[model samples]
Target: MNKKGQLIVVSGPSGVGKGTVLKEYLASRDQIAYSVSATTRSPRPGEEHGVHYFFLSREEFEQTVQSGGMLEYASYNNNYYGTPKKPVEEQRAKGNDVVLEIEVQGALQVKKACPDALLIFIAPPSFEELASRLTGRQTEDSKTVENRLNIARKELLCAKEYDYIIVNDTVELAVQRLAQVISANRYSIKNMKEFLDEVNKHA
Candidate 1:
């Protein structure tokens, strides 16, 4: 069997620089397909559709769930976040890595659906630093910031379940490590044993 591309699952706290790391990682690589999520939340002032997210209506989101169109999905703060199964499967079929930037709940759901997927956790240097970064952004009000911090505290518990943890102290270093993970997963011997056996037969 041919070696298939990997499904990379990434989750982190709100202020852990996950977005920056992903941006730099994408900029440096050509074969990766960043999974665009289907979300019911309205885009922010400058956010674009199909880039930041695939913005959808509540009814459309429900139809996706009902039709088994999503690999995984979850509701948070009254908004729906989901990973569309089609694009990801298509990328994998074409031997291209598909990276999913998901929350812990959705990450677990993907793991259940695709046990071969690689799970990575991106984190800040420390909880205090994460909080500082969140506050400095000025994107949300005090209440919203507090809510995210609370969720971050809960999300920290998921670290143990992840396959690898990358600290986002610097975007360059984080992107480099993420690339390494993608490369290494492609060479996983568990999936290459059959090819080796065939080579031995030829020898």
Candidate 2:
């Protein structure tokens, strides 16, 4: 019997290094599929459509949401961002673990839609560190940074709702922890039934 892939939902506050950790984790694994998100925001330099994001028009995005094609969606800074459901299903059908890097709201929606999904929350070492990371980037103004910090605080509160939390004090250690979580889940009883049945056949 073939093992079905697991759906992992990764979420965290802005500037928590969730992307960096996930990048490193995926680099070390071959069977994992990263779910690319769809957004109405303009693509930045070096970002390719369907690679970094599926850049969509407002009408297109709304149509997808209305058609129930999005796993989850939310508006940020007047732009809509969402995860397309088809790619995730396709990857899972191929027995490749699917990882989704989304915000809290989308994560929750995924949890509701797929109860077996492993919800992991990435956190900064501290609020001061989170603020420093957000400001040190120099990409946003003070007001923007403050707004992100405020949102981060609220998102942090939802961390308890997740199945696991990884504090990204160091990228290397965080990547290790994330890998361990996935590895452990892969061998979980819920995921092992098919393998056990195969063993019973040999027995």
Candidate 2 Cα errors over 4 Å, as ranges: 193-203
> Per-residue CA lDDT of candidate 1, range 1-203, in tens?
44567799999988899988998888868777999999998897889999899999999999999999999998865789999999999998888888999989999988888888899999889999999999999988999899999989888998888989999988889989888887786767755776788898999
lDDT of each: 0.88, 0.91
Looking at model 2, report the run of 10 residues with the lowest lDDT sum: 1-10
Candidate 2 lDDT, tens digit per residue, 1-203? 44678999999998999999999999868878999999998987789998999999999999999999998998766688899999899989889999999888889888888977899999999999999999999988999899988888889999999999999999999999999998898887767878888899999
Which candidate number would show the highest lDDT if scored against the true structure? 2
Q: Candidate 1, which ten residues in sequence have the lowest lDDT sum?
A: 185-194
For model 1 the TM-score comes to 0.93
Model 2, residue 116: C-alpha shift (Å) = 0.8
Best of the candidates, TM-score = 1
